[model samples]
Target chain A: MEKFRANLMLCAGTGCVASGSAKVHAALRDEIKKRGLEDELKIVLTGCNGYCAEGPVMAVYPDEIFYQKLTVEDVPTLVEEHFLKGRPYQKLMFKEPEKKTAIPLMKDIPFFKHQVLRVLRNKGLIDPEKIEEYIARDGYLAAAKALTEMTSEDIIKVIKDSGVRGRGGAGFPTGMKWEFASKVKSDIKFMLCNGDEGDPGAFMDRSVMEADPHSVIEGMIIGAKAIGAHHGFIYVRAEYPLAVQRLQLAIDQATEAGLLGKNILDTGFDFVLEIYLGAGAFVCGEETALMRSIEGKRGMPRPRPPFPAVKGLWDKPSVLNNVETLAQISPIILNGAGWYRSLGTEKSAGTKVFALTGAISNVGLVEVPMGIPLRTIIYDIGGGPKKGRTFKAVQLGGPSGGCIPESLLDIPVTYEDIQATGAIVGSGGMVVMDDNTCMVGTAKFFLEFTADESCGKCVPCRVGTKILLDILTDITEGKGKESDIETLEDLARDILASSLCGLGQTAPNPILTTIKYFRDEYESHIVHKWCKAGVCRDLTTFWIDEKMCKACGACLRACPSKAIVGEKKVPHKIIQELCVNCRTCYDTCKFNSIRILPAGFEGDPYEFLGIGAAAATTGEKKGDA
Target chain B: MPRLTIEDLKKIKEKHRADFTLREGGYRAKVTVHMGTCGIAAGARNVMTALMDEITKANLTDVIITTSGCAGLCAREPLATVEIMDQPPVKYCDLNDDKMRVIFKEHIMGGTPVEKYGLVVGSETTY
Candidate 1:
């Protein structure tokens, strides 16, 4: 293929595909071909760009120009004007939401301004299907070094110097794990890549595998060499079909090209790789459980006196690393320990990729160096909370992690820094929550997930989680007493202490952390009988303002319980007894007649409005979704 | 498809570093046309085409022209930025074919620097 002058790189990640980037890609290709500019201008379909909120994103080559939300309709015009006429397309650019100004450059955008990409270095830039592209960008250099030149001791020493920890929620040193596995003196040791990313809002691992599968492969290869393992397995969750498919293809391609399988690079050393499909159990994310699942068992965690490093998969000494951890290996090996250490803090040397989501304007995958403050991620990278809402707190580390309230937003993002706030930086799932989010409801939601996902091997997780979830549910439904909080704390402590695996052991973290930080929200639920965020529908009553009720029967007709009663062209009333608080009346009220009387609401719901009870009830809040 | 030797990996990285790496000096100047939804509506494609035409006409082999996302200033759509190596990127807002030509010749080739239509005085923009 001849070298192209200008390349239009379009995002082919899942989010962008759902948003019609595929059509835009096809249109751009057709337009380029039609204009006979295919020789000079080429189109490359890449993986997820971090700012998914402004997806279907693309960028031009060499010049490094970023574009968002490209539609097929804009392709002809874009080709005509930009490719043929040399005029910038203003309509297709991102406009600042608050400033109402159309900013065409990425540098001016807050979303991409602060991020320092390392693990996600090739994401959204390189075509993942092409192996040459991966190699062309120093992809396998680290693996070659580990295989041909560096001994197992040297590689482990370099990793130790780099200060990278396991990014799978637990911050264990990679070098120590490798050292333990290497010293085990086992002939049939194994290397495993834990790609079973089951966190609700986490997609960093998935994107890494999808966008740069070779990096992970190389990392695993280097790890196998360091640990004296000849065979490796990547346990990816079944839900991520795209990642799995891409990874399988990469494995095949590497094997064909001598990047994998026997005698890689003809270095007189051998390593074989395979993919193990996970059964989509959340507990399988645990290292031992993942190994058990690979061994054709029920994917339950066995107690560890014999951790994977000493005796693991198939009762052989094994080394298991997170998908993100393994991906960093290639870079650290190629760039020296000092180069890796230069990017992040002293203790945590390297960048972290976070699936930045919820209650924020720019929700996408973000990678930042360690020791960067949460304030920078929220305000600088996330563009703060969505419109008109105050930033309340952010949920980090998925279910096993804790919540960080607004007061701790200034804390630096590191393992130690996160632990200081009683939160684990687990899997780098930073879910920003607004003031409108009820802490009680949030904890209950996570408890429900853990309760349902708890493996029945241990009694603490299996039984304790259900009881805790039942209590949280009753609290949200306004059926809790002051003693329930104490009970919840006690039960949560028991679950954390007695649980057999990480899933059960850390299952109570969200509840414990929320109770620790937002105990007032819990006190309000049990004592005041109110949910401040109005998220607990059961704790709030929906009423109709007598004056604002345009006599419209929209609410009355739509009420499933017949709770609303009003005649056409007159005022309406809500029968509180029949009101189940399904939010049907509130959602159906077209004239803004419905008002919520929160539990323990002292003053009249209308009194807070302070208007003639009609228009005051309906000051259409442009609440950011 | 033989196994890549250590020397092959180094050679490939050297060949592709300029494209993937953020550092400059591989190209003379980088011109970016904002191509978000608003930029496309405001004729950024035309601005890009005009810049490309001028670069081709001038026989400038080193200039790299590309497109970018929203400039945060929506009222001023069709944004264009001209960046020279080691210099700050100058964002030129509200452009057309005529303005693009002047930008191509004077700002890009002449290196005289244009500020009237620009937003930021280039400090830390991408290479």
Candidate 2:
């Protein structure tokens, strides 16, 4: 086999592709040909590189030069100087933020340093659409091994030994789930891959599906063989068009290659895989609801105890695992149980892929060992919060999970560790929060989401979520009575205990966790009728800081309510009655003079700004006098 | 052609193992415009089309163009990363027709990595 002297691996993942990686690829190819160096240098378009903030990204092999934010025009120079002349282009390299020096290799970056890529191992390494590239990396070998070498019981035993749990929120033992399905007497068992990821700010499953569709397919093949299931269904949400397209293409490719469909690997066992597109309902993420949707019924959960293992998917024994769960199976089988078990803590033995988003500087997909600390993920891997903002809290597990304060920054991230904090690792969606975030408002946002997503199948979820949202809305709007806190706690406890399914059972987590960590913020809202973050419009009063205001007409021109009325070069006075508190004037002000005060503050609005309980306790307001 | 079976795939893999040349950058340059929903919202498709038309007009054979999904930075779209063999790769932000041309003439052919326009500059050994 002929190997090129160098390989130029461009990030073709959705993030970099949008940043114009295709143009970069074309320009490089054109430049290489123009320079007559085509045979010596290669350009490989790979999947998501994971460092999404600095894309369209590419890494030159042999030298491993990492370039960020590329354009099509730069391709020729890169081709001429680097591929032909063998010179490193200094301008295209990545610069360290704290240090002024440019970094030469992709691995040297701090973001890539801390990540343990297990699930994301093949993400940036192969062409997802090409089956040959996947085969080259020993992709279907595990399926073949399971089909020919291992018995169904042996496959289940190996999986159980791997200690791999579900990456989906529950963290259920994957092998045990398979074992139940394998032992069931049904002649037609089913394997279901749950791609109905509904959590906000979460896209790890979608990325895996888009970047390495074959991995999920290979995993399903092994799973099907283990469970003695000849039929499989991938239940993906319709919202993820790209994941859907890629998954369908991958299924087609696998079927064409005889890796899927009847008599796979020339073994006697026959299996068929199909796709089931969901209508983008958050409730369908629940196993029962998802199964119902698959059965051409409204997506609603039925009571458990019979569970899916006993009677699932048209009343047949079925095994359902999330996209990430299935994706991990092939690797566990390929590497053996001990190899997989060696990485993480005792309970959660494997890496978890998180959609690291929100106030963090580098927002993208990240996979780390289960026991890694939150501090490491936030500070080291995430490049800290955006704009040097102080870390306040990190919300994990989406709306169904809870907010973890900075006090728990050192806490190891595992199923048990996170769950111990009253937060489940629900689908690995981690949204970082800054100091400016309003805990009450954040809780309210999640309450609203849960209220909208509740299937209304159970009265506790249907009615309780609505009441919770109403109370939260009232508190944020300064109409909340002090008794509302007790009411919220009461509702949270009842909802947790009585909700019909996982969606309702975990619906109050955001509220419960936020209230637990930042009860003071809720107290401030109720007692003082104030929004500490000035995010709640009803509790805030916008005024101009006379010292800082140049009386620039910017606020006057910007305010839709015509709230700011003052002559140029003079301090503007906001009409309290006419001021809709729309915050247009506050946003438009360049002088940083706009201020928001609690309802009772008479003068010097800045006194209320940034004054937490410490200032109140000290009885010494710096700017008050 | 018969549907490819696992045996056929194995045979193909074996056959390709000896003769297959992992072809280096010979075809015309390939431009992958991120047309993922987020990228399109960021205007990646227009930028991609501009680059495509430019390469076509220039009669560039070594280039192949394609599209990809989102790269996380919803705030910055129509972003493009450029790679040439010997030179360091450059990513241009807020790209328009003019910047694309400058990239085509200066970086693609002239062997110079553009400054100012790139988010990160110079190569590192870490990744």
Q: What DockQ does each prediction reach against the true complex?
A: 0.20, 0.06
Highest lDDT: which candidate? 1
Expressed as tens digits, the lDDT of each residue in A1-625 for candidate 2 is: 1324346778888788778888888887787788665654567777788888889888775455788888887777766455543456677888877776888776798888888887887776667777776776667878888888899899999899988898888999999999988888987889999999999999899889988899998888899988888999999999888788888998998887678888786787788999999999999999999999999999999999797988999999999998888888887887899999888988889899999999889888899998989899999889898764588999999999999999999999899889999888889999999976889999989989999999998888999999999999999888899899899999899989998899889999999999899999998788877676678887777778777789878998888888778887778989888888777887678787877677555543445465323322444443311
Where does model 2 exceed 4 Å of error? Answer: A26-29, A543-580, A584-595, A604-625, B1-127
What level of docking quality does candidate 2 show?
A: incorrect
Per candidate, the number of residue pairs that clash is 61, 73
After best superposition, candidate 1 residue A276: deviation in angstroms? 0.6
Among all candidates shown, the one with the greatest TM-score: 1
- The DockQ-based CAPRI class assigned to model 1 is incorrect
What TM-score, to 2 decimals, does candidate 1 have? 0.83
